[model samples]
Target: MTVFDDGERPRGGGPWPIWGIPLVLSLCGLVMIASLSLRNSMTGGSPYAQIVKQCVFFLSGLVLMFACAFSSLRRFRRWSGLLWFIALLLLVGTLIPGLGVRVGGARRWLDLRLMRFQPLEFLLLAVPLFLADRLDRSRREGFQGFLRPTLMVTLLSILPLLFQPNLGGTILVTLICLMMHVENRGWRYPLMGGAFMVVLFVSLVMIEPYRMRRFLAFWDPWSDPMNKGFQIIQGLVAFCNGRLFGVGIGKGLQEDEYLPAAQTDYIFPAIGEEFGLAGTLFLLSLYAVWTIRAYRIYRRCSNPFLSVLTLGLTMSIIGPMFINIGGVTKLMPLTGIPLPFVSAGGSAMLFMWAKVGILMRINKISLGEGRREREPEGC
Candidate 1:
């Protein structure tokens, strides 16, 4: 049976409802960014500068989303390798002295003159596309089938992320690959891969003093409340102060100075401080609903590539969302990962919208156009 009958198909040529949640969340993000950055903007001599930039990024993201939504999946799959190669080059280029911009001691952005772009964000799409393409071609079974593609992705993608010293990005990319692998290869290969990943992640963390410090902070923020614990402490205070309905937008004290990285990493706390617990729950509900929709689309997709693609893309957004939110709430260590759709980062915003576009396109293909019965050769 088809996933959706003709009458149940989305109207107006797109998955408007699926696309609508991110649109609303992003708009909310703009308001929150404006509120959270008000003090920084004032101190910098332009009260509206940050919000204005965010507006430009949001609009630009919209354009990219529309373009990707209308494009053919076959074309995307065809160019997957090229896109992945370009992404790796960008990742390596960020380590070059004159080309990469260092901010807060980490070199992760390419100096584009107009704006800085994070190369890891490109991996959000590239890794999934490349994996889908590889899996489509591979006919081997068991360890060889999984190991070949897994090793290729790890070397080309995850290695760059770790050297960037972005442990969070490394973890995110690893999880994406794991999810895709599990979907295609089932529990055995993925379980083995997961164990290997865990050991690697812990060893990497132990090797870096700063990462160790962050991990330690997660356990006992009070041990160094004045230093390592400050951000988490302030984040907690933001939630406490927010109480029920929030302190009312722009009225919160955390972003004025107490909370560092308030507009980016800790934006979730800022939302809690201004919009209150109710608003926070509402925001999370939007994410939950959006995720459910993505899963539904995944189930209905008859194409293996599209099915795995959907899973990876969904995790790409949801994984970071949980990490960011959990970090701010002291449920996990601060990973310096931005809250998807709500944080102030141009590259992240653009990639997120593009993913949304791809999901919508997949939904359209699965539901409206009907399913194809063909599966990849070996499977």
Candidate 2:
């Protein structure tokens, strides 16, 4: 497929599934969290605390979404550098003496007095905006022209995440940057790039013993059932418990007692336990629809910056979705990234909305471009 597959905007399409699917998924998250919160309350773990916090996050996420949607894409392009720089600082801050919060032995969060924030999530949006702005044809284009900036951004971004020991984010961000820079020129480049990516992943796994163990555990979780495999095993049990139609919304056994990250990393399995195969399939379909629609926006986009930005933004969501689901389902080692709109992560929710907002802006601009193109036909 050529870089930006611009074509006649799909028929019967005005405001498409891009926005609607996330709203549905976000609502599902809220309902699921509320259910989990109720169970926590029953166990005397502070009633509705999870829901209350998530409610605040959900509202704040909407604000971030609208702010991005209404703002000028030009401004984002202009400010992409500053935003990325600030993100870099925050990411580095996560490693500072007292500034960083240690969770699961990884310093990936900042425990501000009010709440915790993951700078990594912000980087997901910032890196794309930066790359789209810097790599646009207006400044420079083509493989040789864009290679330096792409490598620089990838190295700078990936290093801190690696130190944070966030292999998943590192891989996702690195690949997204690589994916954005590929030109339509012939097979040699992509083939080489693909080989490079494989080497990079293998190297990354080899460098970290924990990562290697996880990789091996992915192939046979039974080998390390108590340690590396526990989360996936629990997640699988949730799927088993869910079976077909699930045990009912609030009645799930996994989220209440067994499942490891029922509201975040393993939320997919929790969804399985409560919603069943039918519900899980429906949710998967929503994600599929969301992915297809985002690409549709990318394809129709006329501007070069917006075009690359659309692909990058689409990756920000879909990449995490695949990584998280893969880990939970034992398709791959769990990287501990939250599911897109369905995870109960505050930083994740805010950034997820930000991505959707940017796409909405692009969709609006593309539609306008389409309308303007059609106006001359009437004359």
For candidate 1, lDDT tens digit of each residue in 16-96? 767899999999999998887678655775768889999999999999899988777877888899999999999998899
Tell me how candidate 1 scores on lDDT: 0.83
- Model 1 pairs in collision: 246-276
User: What is the lDDT of every predicted structure here?
Assistant: 0.83, 0.81
TM-score of each: 0.93, 0.91
Off by over 4 Å in 1: 1-14, 370-379
- Evaluate model 1: give its TM-score: 0.93
List runs of model 2 lying over 4 Å from the truth: 4-12, 137-143, 183-191, 369-379
- Give a tens-digit lDDT track for model 2, residues 233-317: 8888889998999999888875456777787887889889888999889989999988888877777765667677888889889
